[model samples]
Target chain A: MSVTPALDARREFESLLEPVATVAYRVAYNFTRNAEDAMDLVQDSTVAAFRSFDTFQKGSNFRAWFLRILTNRFYKSRKRGRVETTPIDEAEDVFLYRQAARAGLLGNDDDPARLVLDRFDVEAVEAALDRLPDEFRDAAVMYFLNDFSYDQIADVLGVPVGTVRSRLHRGRKILQRALWDVAKQRGLVHGDGPEGAGA
Target chain B: MGTARRAPVPKDMSCAEVFARVQEYLDRELNPDEVEAVKAHLDYCPPCARGFVFEESVFETVRLKLAASACPEDLMARLRECLEACDES
Candidate 1:
């Protein structure tokens, strides 16, 4: 019966992971657009999580812990492959808000967010998210899509909470631009050229 | 005539300041004082308020939709297998 504790530990991990597995995979897939790579990431991170189970606090946020492992592994692998040192995009935040305002899209009493939301479906949102650079895209997906709190995102990304805040701020601005362009291409909004040139 | 309470300075948290921190506000990352300041600005600023609504909706609508999506069935099976292997090992 020496294996009983280990077995129980495994079972507990599995049970905890069950509910978050899909989300974990989704997060991984968003990190790596390929399915196989995503699966490998999930498995690798899950196995890592299993090994580090003892360090995990039982009552605390297991999902965040596991996702931290997943994201750490991902960043580590990228480091091993090649070092990418791009500066964070520090462009004006709320690109869409400005664009909408210029296009008179925000002039109406209509819900601007709803107006934006109605223009694009999930796939379009995903596409727009995918277009973001690695740093911003990861934060955007984790926060907006994966529902990670700023704390969890900071832990997962191995950055400070302030960095997470900036990344999300910039990421969202970039996403707004992406969404605006996509909507225009689809004719979802009329009048004014891209980036509000006409308006 | 009844005296009215003083109106907000309108300069307290200008539209620019509110816009700069709107994401934090929407994410509920602000402290009480900060939240109140942002709220005061939002109250008087219709355009900023509408922008806040729009920004909030973008995160919410997308989050809800993407959250409902599950991984592929085969991927789930593989992940389960992964757990089983780890358990046995």
Candidate 2:
């Protein structure tokens, strides 16, 4: 198909790039699980998106379109094999929910600490996220963490909407378990028996 | 173990179900009946309530962390280089 002139397309793409960069980085980080990989993914996706700018329908979700390209690139590069999946057992699931509740209760809106990240073990949570399988992790990061709607996530992943929901559900379950395990070990949470012990 | 535990909630509402609907509740997407069900469940179940709390916290944490970890100076230079190369071709 005939496309916009290269210079004009580049200008338009440049204008859209900055606003979407943070979201793109978040999506790439979730998929690749490393800063280096995420950077490469964003760069490659940007180039590819710029080249195909003609097909990108105007007035549509640009972030989702760009993410779809990035996620597709990620899977293509993974032709070697799929990552190992970590399953969350039923007991761990229950404990995770309980701990999440307690954490919520401790921090209130009036508390200044609530607004800051000082007390929370963000590093621990990030560590747990790093261990998730690529698909679920990417889905969770894009949908929940990035604040994309389910339809947006589906568009970005180029998957059916139902698959997006399924990945998010499974991903959240895994994260809940992982976060509990990490927090319990670090003593960030109390009264939750050792990870997997209560279950 | 307490009066809250003894209260009756809808049989359809399990922790998983409540967890799934947490996002809906936050977004105000739940209908009156479903909202009531989730509210009643949250009222009785500490774990489910905690789970929602953690979810919100993690969500905020992820957002802040991502924002803080912007494209580094070197990465921005590299990106500029890549764009320049693309323009040349």
Candidate 3:
């Protein structure tokens, strides 16, 4: 049996790719918000990654390196132009904590974060994540889903570290607001007024 | 109840300043000095500490919830097949 350079490359690529395949699929799903499209994206990205496998530096971060390719494929295949910005609001930075404080839920008896988490099942939390603008959602997913550092996220998103910081800052605020609205609609928490108002 | 003696407020960092960097603190983006500054403030202020805990808990909850999604078997199979095909061509 001849072990050619091509065969060696294939084995190495497979070994590296298998571990990250699940994460790649999830990232694609977050991008497409559809299973079939996500599959296509993952497939396309995997094939592309293999063809250029030699370029991947050894002993480097394989996940971030592969995700850079996957994210590029996602951006290129898009017919719709990416939305780079969301309108900045005068919203409080820690909106949920503030809301919980005003509603008297931050006392010794009540853990506001636990209250929100207990009320929102995984599906509800994911739905709230889906409601964020694409840029914010992508940043939040990259950071929260895989524990990617801000610098790693910047490398994957192809932005400056500062941009990643701002996106996460805004993304957390937006996610909190969405969670608050969903909880209100479901009557999970009783508030004296709407989200921003004192309860 | 006896009045509790709190550590004097950190001179370099105010509550507002600590709050502003709270997200970075949670995300571990702050450098050591910045983190120490934020920690100093949180040590003295119970309200600020509670706020930080709430933010951290929310982030941890979301992380665990989102990571619970498993990649479907069919997608994994197709991905494997694509790799095999790449080897052939």
TM-score of each: 0.80, 0.70, 0.82
lDDT for model 1 comes to: 0.74
Candidate 2 displacement at residue A18 in angstroms = 1.8
Interface RMSD (Cα, Å) for model 1: 10.6
Model 1 docking tier (incorrect/acceptable/medium/high): acceptable
| Model 2 lDDT per residue over B45-86, tens place | 975776667556655564566445445555545666777689
Q: Model 1 segments beyond 4 Å from truth?
A: A1-5, A79-93, A101-112, A193-199, B1-11
Q: Count the backbone clashes (under 3 Å) in each candidate.
A: 1, 3, 0
lDDT of 2 by residue, A35-96 (tens): 77888888998888887888999889787777777767877775222345455442334344
Residue pairs clashing, model 3: none
Q: Can you write out model 1's per-residue Cα lDDT over A164-187, one digit (the tens) per residue? A: 877787788777767776677678
What's model 1's lDDT at A11?
78
DockQ of candidate 3 relative to the true structure? 0.33
- Using TM-score as the measure, the top candidate is 3
lDDT of 1 by residue, B1-89 (tens): 11223233343877777888888888898777778988888888877887788778877877876676557777656766887887777
The DockQ values of the predictions, listed in order, are 0.29, 0.17, 0.33
Give the better candidate number (1 or 3) by TM-score.
3
Candidate 3, residues A119-148, lDDT tens digits: the string is 787767777777688878888987886568
